[model samples]
Target: MKGINITSITLYSTVAFSSLFRSCAFQVVPTGCGGSRQPSTPSTSTGIGIGTGIEPAPTNSNTIHNNHVMSDDSFGSRRQLITSLVPSAIVTATGVSILLSPQLSFAEDVQVDPVIVDPVIVAPTGEIKKLFNEGRALEQQGNIQASQRIFAKVTKLAPRFIYGWAYLGNSQVALGSLDPAENSYTKAVNLCVESRKEEEKLGIPRCNDLYLLYLNRGSLRLNNGMAMAMAKEALLDLEAADSLRAKPDAVILQNLARAREVNGLYAASDRDYTVAISMTSNEVSPFWLRAALVKFQLGDTMGSFDLIRRVENRFSEAPEVRAALAAMLYAKGDQDIDTARKKFLEIPDRQRLKYRNDEFLLNTISWPPRMIDNIKALSDAVGDAGRVEI
Candidate 1:
C-alpha cells in the first residue's frame, strides 16, 4: 500500500454488532508495509508500523510516497520483522520514497497510474456460471447441502473463478464445516493473488473477495491456538482492502478486535475495539464491551458493571449482550432473588437449554452445581469481557 494516500484508516474499521457510531482519522503504518502483497525478502528486508485512524480516502490506485516494506507471504514472521524496523516515534511521510526491496518502493516520488488488466474468463463452458447460480439459489432456499454441492462443482469446473471459491466457502460455513470452509476461502484468496500477478488488475471485487475470505478464516481461528496470529493477519488484510476501496467498513474491524479478545490479546483487542467505535455510527456496544473488559482486567469491578448497565439500556433485546450482562451481575455477587429470577427469565428459552445439556458448561461448573454460582461466575467473565455467556 505504498504511494497511496491513506486519508482515514479509522473510517474503514468500524465497530460491529452495534449498528451505530462514526468518526475518522489518518493512520500511518510506522514500521513498514510488507508481506503477502509483495515477494519475501531476508528477515532484515523490511519493517512494519501503524498510526492512528483517520477518515475514509477516495478510491483510486494512485501511488503515494511513504514508508513501505518488502513483500513477504509468511505473515507472522513478516509482522515481527516490520515491528522491529519501525521507530517508536510517530511516523510521517509527505512524498518520500521508502524502499521495501530492490524491486518495490513504498512511494515512487512520481505518480504512476494504476495498471488495469482485463479479467480472464475462467468459467468453463458456462458450467461454472451455472453452478454459481445454482449455489445461490440453493442457499437462498436454505438448502445448504445442495448449495455446497453446487459450489463445489463450480470450483472444480473453474478453479480460478474467485467468486466460485468465495461462495463455496460461504456455503461450507453455513453447513458447519469450518475446516472445509477455511480451505475454500484459502483457495479464493490464492486465486485473487494469482490473478493480480497475471493480470495487473487490482479491482475492488478481487480485493473484496480476499477480504471476506480472511474475515471468515480469522473468525474460524478465534478459539484455536493460532487465534492471535490469524486474527492479526485477517485484520491487516481487511485494512488493506478497505484502504484500497476507500469505503467505510467497520464490521471487519470489529470482528478483528473480537478475535483478538478471544485469544487473550487484551491490549491489542482493546485498541482495535476502541478504534472501531470511534470510526463508526452511534451504537455503543463495542465501546461498552472493550471498555468494560479493560476495566475488569484492571480490577475495577464497578466500572465493568457500569458498562453492562449502559449496554442493557441500549441493547437489552440482544441475546448475546443480555447473556453477557447476566453473567456479569451473577459474578458481582448481587443476590437479590427477585432480580435473579427476572434475569434468568430474561434469558432466551432457546439458549437456556445449555443449562441442561451443554457438556462443557456442565463440566466447567461441576455438573448439577448450584445455579446461582454458575450464573455469577459466568456472568462476571462475560460481562467483563463483553462476550456472550453460555
Candidate 2:
C-alpha cells in the first residue's frame, strides 16, 4: 500500500474483505485526450496501511467535488472507499486518508492490473432518521395517515431499513389495510433477519425489536383466521419470538398460547398459557380467561368454569371481562347459553355507551378467529331482545 497513488485502487488476485460482502464497484471512466491511461502494474501483495495528505492524480482542469469524485473511474472517493471497506468498524480520520483493509492476502509476486473503482457509497441515514422521527411524532399526535406517507418515503429512501418497514406495517395495520400491512411486515421480517445475521458476524447480540416484529406479524395472522396452515405459520412466528426472548413475556406467551391452541398443540398451548398466567400482573384477567378456555378444550370442564368464575368474581364490574368469558362459554354449545347470554347482554346502556363496539373485544382482547366468530354469534343470538335499552 506504500507510495501507491491515492487515486488508484489496488486490484489483486486475492480479495481483501470477506466474500459475504457485496462489492461497491465504481464505473472506470478514462479521461485525457487519449482513450485510457495505462495503469501501472500492481506491486507484490503485502500488508495494507492507510496514508494521509497524498494529492489526487493530476487532471486537465478536471474538478471533482465531494459529491462526484472521478478517478479515471466514474466514481472514487478516498473517504467512501474506506467506509465501504470496513464493515462494523469505527473510523475517525483527521483529513484525506486512503485505506487498505487487513487480512486480504494477495498472490506473492503476481503482477496484476491496478484498477480504481467508484465505490457505491451508501447514503447516510441522517435524512432518513429525521423523516422517521417526524413520522413517529405524527403517530404520537394521532396522525397515522400522514405518518404512513412519511414512512413510505423512508422505505423508498433506504429500502433495507428495518424500523422503517416495521413502522410502515404498523401504520397500515392501523388504517385497516391488512394486505399491505402483511407485506410490509413480511419485508421487515426478512430485513431484520439479515440485520441480525450481520450483527452476529460482528459478534454482537441479537436486537430486541426482532421479537416484537414476530409478535405483531404472528398476532395478525392468528387473529385474522384459524386456518390450519396460517395457525401453524403463526405458531412458528410466535415460537420464534419466544426463542428470542431473554425471559418469559406474558403478552407474547398469551399470543403464542392462542396460536398453539389453534394448531391443536394442546399440551404446548397449556404450558404457554400457564407461563403467561404466572407472568401476567397488570392484565391478569385476560390471561386467566384464555387459560380457562384452554382447560375447557383439554377436558377440564369443571376446572375451566372455576377459573372463569374466579375472573367473574374478581372483575365483575368490567364489561370486557363479562363479554369475553361469556362469548367463549356460549360458543361451547353445551352450557346454559341463556345465562351466558344474560352475562354478556345485561350490561346497562349507560356503561355500554363506552364499550359500544367490537374494538374492545376484537382488538384489546384480540380474540382468536374461532373465539371472534363465537362473539359474533352471541351478538346475533339475542338480537333486539338482548340489546339493552337505555
Candidate 3:
C-alpha cells in the first residue's frame, strides 16, 4: 500500500525476523565515567554515501564530531551542510563561534552542562558478527538459556541494532519467561516502526521489519493467553505486509490461525491451521489443539478425547497439554459421577485428587486419607464377604 510490495513469503519472513531482533539502540558504556552518554536523536545510515570516518562525540572531553554539519537545528555531516550553505551570502560571511569546556574529575559534583552529541554509526565488526552467529547457532540447537544471554549481550553492545531485540525476545520466550519476552518484543516493534518511519520519510526502500515485529508480538501474546490483543495486532501486521511478493510462510499462517482461535473465530481459525499444517514438515502441537478444539466445539467428544490422548502421549512433558488432559478428565467425570469415580480411582494416589479438584490441587498427598482408612477398616472387618464393587 505504501509502494512497498509485500507477499506471503515476506509476511512470514517479517514475522520470523520480528521474533529475532527488534532494537536500534546501540549499547555504549563510558570508558571511565559511570554513565554512558546516549544520543538524543535516532541514527540513519546510507551505508554507501555516508562517510565512515566520523567518530562518536567524546562525552567527557566535550568534543563534538559530525561528518555533516548542522544548520537551523537540523543534524547532519559538516560536508553536507557546507555544500548546501556555500551559496548563501550570510552563511559564508558570518563566522560561528566554537566553544570548549574543561573536563571535571569523576568524583567531584561538577555542574557542567551535558553536551548533546549526534549518534555515531558503526558497521558491525567481525567479532560482534561472530557473537551474533554463535547466539543464533545456540538458539537453533535448543540452548535457549545460553542463546538468550548471548542476544542480551548483542543488544547491550549494539542498542540501535535491529536484530538484537527480536532475538533476545525469542530467547526469552524459549526460556518460558513471558513477561521479559513481551518487553523485548515491545522494544523490537518500537524500533522496527521507528526505522520504517525514518525510511518512509527518506523515500527509501521499505523494511519488512515492522510487519514481522507485529506478527511475532501477536504470537507471543496468543501463547500467553492474551488472545484478543494478539489477534488484532497480527491482523494489522499481516495487512501491512499484504503487498509483499513472498508467499505466506507456515509459521505466519500458524500464528494467524492461533490468533483467530484465541479470538474465538473457530471456522476461520480452523481453516488457517489446516493450511499451516499442510505446509509445515514438522508435527506441531498447535495443529493438534486447533483440530481438537473444532471437534470439541462441534460436540465431537470422542474425537476431542482421541486428540487429547495423542497430545498426552506425544507431549506428555508439556504442562499445557497436561492441564488440558486434566480438564477433559474432570469434565468427563462431571458428566458421569460413576465413570468419574472409576477414572479418579485409576489415577495414581498423588494425581487422583488432581482429577477430582480442578485447577491446582490443594494438599494432594493427604487427600481422602480418612475416607481411605474407613474403607480399609470396613473391608478388613467384612473380609471376603464385604468385597463390593461400587
Candidate 4:
C-alpha cells in the first residue's frame, strides 16, 4: 500500500485525538490519509477542539439536581453547536482512510455494504463539457478552490444543469464553504424536481441526481447543528434521499442516528446506531465512540463499557482509548480505585492536564474524598514538572 503523507496524517490524528479525547487526556498516534478528491482545508484541522464544561459541585443531592438542570440548559445549547460542527470535521478527518490504506479494502476488511444507487448520466456539449471534465479532474486532484471556480463557470454557462450545480456544491463542501454548498445543493434539488416533471411527460426514468443532491444537502444541514429550526428540514431531506435510493447507505443511517440523538429521540437513534455498526462490522470506527457516548448519557453504563472495551482492545496502543476505558471503569462504581489510578498515572505528564480538567469524568467518577485529593496532588505534581508541548 502507498504510504499516506505523514504530515497530513499527523494533522488529522491530532484533531481526532484532541476532539475525542479532550477529557481523556491521552496522546493519539496519528493514522490514516485524506481522500484524493477531498479538499485539504486547514479549517477542518484547526476546528477539532472540544470544549470542557466543569464546575464546582453542590454539597447535597438536591442541590446537585438543581445544578444539573442549570448545567444541562447551558451545556445543551453549547453541545448543540458542537454536535453540528464535529460531524463534518469527523467525516473530513476519517472518510478518506479507506482510500489511503489500499492494503485494507473496505469490502474485505470493513465489510461496508454500501447501497448501490444508479449513476446519473449527463451529456454536455462544446465548452461546457470541456470545463465540466476539467473541474472534476481538479477536484480529484484536491485542487478544491480551482475546481470551485470551474464549477462556478459551468453553473453560469448552464444554469439548468443539475449535475453542474451538484458538483459545484461538492467542491464548495471540500473548500469548507458550507453555506454556499447548501445553496448549490438546494438549486440542484429544485432543478431536479422541475426536470422530473418534464421527464415524466416524456416517459423517461427518474433522475438519480435528486437523491445525491438531497443526501449531500442533508448531511451538511445535519452536521451544521440541528438545534436550529433547520433540523426538521435536514430530516426531511435525508428521508427523501433514503426513499429515492433503492437501498439505504450506512452513512445515511449513521447521520440519521446522530440527528435523532440530538433531537432527544434516543430509542430511534439507538436502533440506527446498532444497524450502522452491524453494517460496518468494524469496531474502531468513530461511530462506535459516538454510540458509546450516547449509551453513557442514557445511563446504559454496561453498554457504554462494552463499546469502550471494544475500542480499547482494537486500539490498545491508543492512549485515548486507555484513558477512556479507565474513566468508564471508574464510572461503573465497583472498580478498584487503585487500578483506575494506575491507568490514570500511566498517561504521560503532558496529557495529564486534560484529564485533570475534564468535566465529565470529574462529575461521573465515584471518587472518595481522599482519592480526589490524591488525584489532584498528582496532577499538580505533573504540572510542576513542566508540560509537554503538543
Candidate 5:
C-alpha cells in the first residue's frame, strides 16, 4: 500500500449472500470470479486492522489474546465495525465502528483478481480450482452448507492458495462459524503478505487489495469471545488498506478515525473525522463533528476551537449544531459559562426541550459520551446558567 495507485477491484463473495456484488460491483462469472479486470499488483501482506461496515485494508498481524476488553485494542484501534456484528469503536460513543465481522465491511463483496500472485509462484492446481469454483457456485446458489464443506476441503488441499483461503473464510461466515472464519481470513491474509514479500524480492509490484482490505460488514464483526486487543490490531491493519477505495464511504472513515483517536494518533484521526464530516448527511454531520470536537477537546483544545469555529461558520443556527456547541461550552464550566448560557438561550424552547429529553439524545441524537454528560449538567443548571439567566 506504499503509494501504489490502487486500480478498481469489484466486490464479490464465493461464500454466500452476495447479490449486491453481482449488481453493484461486478458481474459474477459462473465459471470463476471472472469479471471486469483492472491492472493491479500481485501480492498482499499480513497486516490486520479492525474495520466495520464494508470493504477492508491490510492490517497488522498481532495475535490478540481473547481476554482483553474493547478499549484494550490499543491507541485508536481501527474502528472496524461490521455494523451490528463487529464489536466497534475506540469509544462506543458516537458510533465509531471496529473489527471485521463475518460478512466483513472491508471485504464483504470481494472479487479477487485472478492473477493474484507473481508468475513465479506455483498457482493452485486445476483440481483445486475446480473444487473452489464448485464451492463458489454452491455459495452463489445460496447453499452455504454445501459451499462451506467444499471450501473447507479446498483450503485444506491448497493452503497456499489465497483464493482458497478467502473462499473458505467466506463460507465459514455464512455458516455462522465466526471464530473459524477469522482463522481462515487470518491465514489468507498471511498468504497475501508472504506473496507480497516474494514480489518485493523479485522486484515485482503487486497490489494485494483483495486480502489487504477484506473486512466485510459481515466478516468485520468480532467474535464476542475474541479479545478486543486482537480485534484492534486487525482493525488498525485494515485501515491502512482503505486508500484503495475510489469513493470511500463516510462510515468507514469515521470508524477508522475513532480508532486512530484511541491510538492517540490525533492528527490523522482528526483529518479522517473532518473529511468524514463533509461526506455525511447534514442531519448526521453535526453529531460526528460533535464527536470530533470532544475527541479534540480531550487531546488538543486548539483543534476543538478550530473545529467549533468551522461549525459555527458552516451550520450557523442549526438546532443540533447549536445544542452541541452549547453543551461543549457548558462543559467548560466557569471558563465559558456565559457563552454556554447564551447558546442554550438561542435555541427555541421546543428544540431545547428535545435536548433535555435524555432518551431522545441517546437514541436519536447519537451524542458522544462526554457531551451527553455535559448535556445533563446543562439541563440541570441554576441561576446564571439557568433558563432565567440575566
Candidate 6:
C-alpha cells in the first residue's frame, strides 16, 4: 500500500490560507506609484492619522480635501482584522513548514495493532463432566460395554449435552447397536442445532462434534450395505460433515468420494477424490491409491498409470505400492507381463501377510496365475533365506 505524501497534501491547505486573505478588508498600496492620497470624510468623533503624518481634516467645513481620513471606529475594525488574520497566518506557516521539511511524513506507515481476543472457556456441569470422562476412560481401556453404560447414563442425566450424545453414539457403534447409535447421533445433531446461537456467542466451535457424529453415522450406514437407501443417507451425512469442518479431513473426503462413486456420481466423486489427494502430504496416502482406482474405473487408464507410477517412484519397496503397480501393468496386457512379474516378486511375504485380510487391497490386486506363482516363489525364497541364516 502506498502512503499519502504529507508534503504534497499540505500544499492544498497553503492555497486555502491564501484564499482566506483574498477577501481581506485591507488593500495593498503600490510603492513608487505617484498618486495623490484621496481624502475621506471625517465623522463627528476624534480622528486618528493612518498615513505618514497626515493632519486630520476639520469636520466643521463642508469641504472635500485630497487627503485620506480615518476615524477612531477604524481602530476597532483593524483590531478585529488582526485577530482573524493571526489564526490563518499561523495555519499557513504550519502548512509551509510541513511542506518544506524532509523528516515530516504522514502516519500512513504505522500499522494498526491487532485485537487478540481470549478464547471462551466452557466448563461442563460437574456431574456431566465426570460421566463423560469415565466413559472416555472406559472406551480408551477397550471396555466398550462399560463405556456404553456410562455414556447411556450421561445421556439420561444431561440429554442436551452434545458430547455426551456423541460419545454414547460411538459406544453404541462399538457394541454393534447400529439402530441405537443412529438415534444417539440424531439426538446430538438436533441439540447442536438448537445451541448454535449460544455456542457462537461463547466463542465455542461445536460444528466439529456435529461433523464427527454425521461422519460416523454415514460410515456405519455405508459399511452395513443393507440397502441403496442407506448409501444415499450416508452420502447426505458425509456432505454435512464436509460443510461443518473448517478444513475437511482427507479421510472424510475419501469416504464421501467413495459414497458418491457408489451412487453413480462419477464426476463429483472424481472431484472429491482429487481434493482429498491434494490435501494429503503423504505420497503413498490411501487417497492417492483410491483416486487412482477411480480413474481406472472411469477408463482413464493413462491417468491411473501415471498416479501408480508416482507411488512406485516414492515408495518403490512398499508392498502396497508394488501390488498396485503390478495390477496396473497387468491391465495393460502381455507386453508389460515381464516387468509386472519382476515388480510382483519384489513384495516380501511378511509384508503381504499384514494386508492379507484387507478387503480393498485384495480386490485391487488382479491375482492372476502368474502373480500367484510369483508370490509363492518369493515366499519359498524367504523361507530358504531364513533357514540359511539360522
lDDT scores of the candidates, listed in order: 0.43, 0.51, 0.42, 0.48, 0.46, 0.47
Instruction: State how far residue 221 of model 3 sits from its true place (Å).
Output: 1.7
What number of backbone clashes does candidate 4 have, counting pairs of residues 3 or more apart or in separate chains? Answer: 1
Number of the top candidate by TM-score? 4
lDDT per residue as tens, model 1, 1-390: 322221112211232322111111111111111101110111112211111111112321111111212121212211111122442343357765554422333433434455443343222234555555666566545666787788788777666566566566655544556578678767766665654445222221212234434444554444222433455564555455445435544545555555545445667656766666565435454335544554555456776677667767876765545545555555556574445445755766555434434443322211112333445455443332343445
Of the candidates numbered 1 and 2, which has the greater lDDT value? 2
Ten-residue region with minimum lDDT total, candidate 1: 31-40
Question: Distance (Å) between predicted and true CA of 210, model 4?
Answer: 2.5
- Which 10-residue window in model 3 sums to the lowest lDDT? 2-11
Per-residue lDDT of candidate 2, residues 269-304 (tens digit): 889878766654433343466667667667677867
Q: Tell me each candidate's TM-score.
A: 0.49, 0.53, 0.47, 0.56, 0.42, 0.48
lDDT of 5 at 65: 10
lDDT of 6 at 372: 40
Report how far off residue 360 is in candidate 4 (Å).
12
Task: For model 6, state the Cα shift of residue 188 in Å.
Answer: 1.7
Q: At residue 1, what lDDT does model 2 achieve?
A: 12
Ranking by lDDT: 2, 4, 6, 5, 1, 3
Whichever of 1 and 4 has more lDDT, that candidate is: 4
Off by over 4 Å in 5: 1-125, 173-176, 199-207, 214-228, 242-252, 264-267, 277-390
RMSD of each: 19.0, 24.3, 18.6, 24.5, 21.2, 40.4
